[model samples]
Target: MRVLVFALGEDDAPRVVQFARQLGAVVDVVVAASHLSSGAARIAGVGRVLAPDRPCDGSAEAVAALLASLASEYDVVAAEANSLCGDALPRAAAQLGAPMVSHVVAIEDGALLHPVQAGRAIAATRVDPLFFCTVRGDAFAAAPLGSHPAPIVPVPAPPAGDTIRLVRAAARHTDSGLTQARAVVGLGRGAANPAFSARAAALAEALGAAVAGTRPAVDAGAVPESALVGQSGRSISPDLYIALGVSGAWQHFAGVRDAKTIVAINSDAHAPIFEWADYAWVADLEGALPELLAALKR
Candidate 1:
């Protein structure tokens, strides 16, 4: 089987490429070379790297056209499940009249395994050989850069007529820290107190984690609006998610269902977060914060 990987962003490229290799032999990779620091094509199991002559930023229509054109040669085409790829891949699939899958976590029994019903259950789907998929970044480890660099070929951008153009982007919109964080510290209503919020931030610092919060915590002024994680906010799939004083609402949990490990700390043992958390600490945040911080420091 031959696989084609579409990685327009540097952050999720390695992980998406690694996942693609698991599906089949990754021969050609359509990448954003200027976005990467070094030999962006120096990834393990890749042969030729196809880079665009023009910039890939906000070029969803062009990328889609490129993918649809080359997709016939490969059995599977894939990318990480992000906003850009999410926009492009669907368009490409539609053009090819092909089936597509998103948020793919694993491959089992020759079927793509993805979550359904807001992560309530797993669904095994089998698409035709010529199919498109977007992988969950946190599901696979990033592929290490290989010593041998693949040959880079510059492909011309197709005519993307009548496409929405990006004028200017806010710095905050580009901050994908929470989605890319290996570990995340989530603040809830329990951490709304100023003192507890301080301790939570310290804990996040200790863990080298990005700090996020539920709607209530953000509304209570415990965290910034950018830190909010829920249905209305960004969905994250960090490797480790530690919640402080969190009572899990389904909307909030939906954003973090892809997390590898969930640890919820709340005084209420019956808190909704506990039901989903792998580890539950039934303790008040006021008392638990100091001890936890001390242990982490030690």
Candidate 2:
């Protein structure tokens, strides 16, 4: 099969390339960013690397146009399931009149396996040939950089008109802010109240930890969507993850599964989070938070 994999110098590129090779594909990699080095393409073990003449700063329309133009030549189009690729792939797929899938965890029996209903169940979907999709970065091992380097192919600049242009890029807190934190304090439904939310922030600050939240907390306006840690949000591997009032749903657990130590504080003994916690405490968050904060102060 002929596969075109999009790349942006992300950690997940090697893994996405490895997956393409597993399918016995003749892979062609497209570097979507402005800076191009043959080294990245060499590491991916592809024969050809296509790059734009000039670097584009996260412009979905230019990428979509490029991918749409190239879509007909390849049997499959794939990219790492990231913010940039996530937006561009769907737009490109729409241009080609092809189906698109996101958050793909695995490929089994010619079908894509991905989480559905917020990780409540796994769904296997089979798309028609010449489909576009995104693969989860953590699901596969990265391919080693090969000794041989691939040839670079430079493409012309995309047309500029009637497209949504990026004015300026703002640094996202979720990018390096939360992911780099050694300790993370995760708030859930119990932290929805203004009092509990403020306490959670104070405790996190006192403990020198980053504050994260579940989807419910984000939906309830307790925190921004960037602070959400779950299957649908940012995946982190912190040294310590303290989940407060989190029920331990699979979607939320997927993000913190690699934490060195998991500490769960929930009132319900049967809360699913307790099953995976290294330390589980059954206590009301309202009552327990103050005491915990006071003890920490002393």
Per-candidate total of colliding backbone pairs: 0, 1
Worst 10 residues of 1 by lDDT: 162-171
Query: Taking the tens digit of each residue's C-alpha lDDT, what string does model 2 give over 182-298?
Result: 899998997778999899989988989988889898899887665678776666668899999899999889778878999999999999999999999999998999999999999
Model 1, range 140-175, lDDT digits (tens) per residue? 888888988888888765554523332111123235
- Can you tell me which runs of candidate 1 are displaced by over 4 Å? 37-39, 59-63, 160-182, 187-203, 212-240, 244-247, 254-271, 277-298
lDDT comparing candidate 1 with the true structure: 0.77
After the best TM-score superposition of candidate 2, give how far the Cα of residue 147 lies from its true spot, in angstroms.
0.4
Worst 10 residues of 2 by lDDT: 165-174
The numbered model that scores best in TM-score is 1
**What clash pairs does model 1 have?**
none
Candidate models: Cα lDDT each:
0.77, 0.77
lDDT accuracy of residue 169 in candidate 2: 17
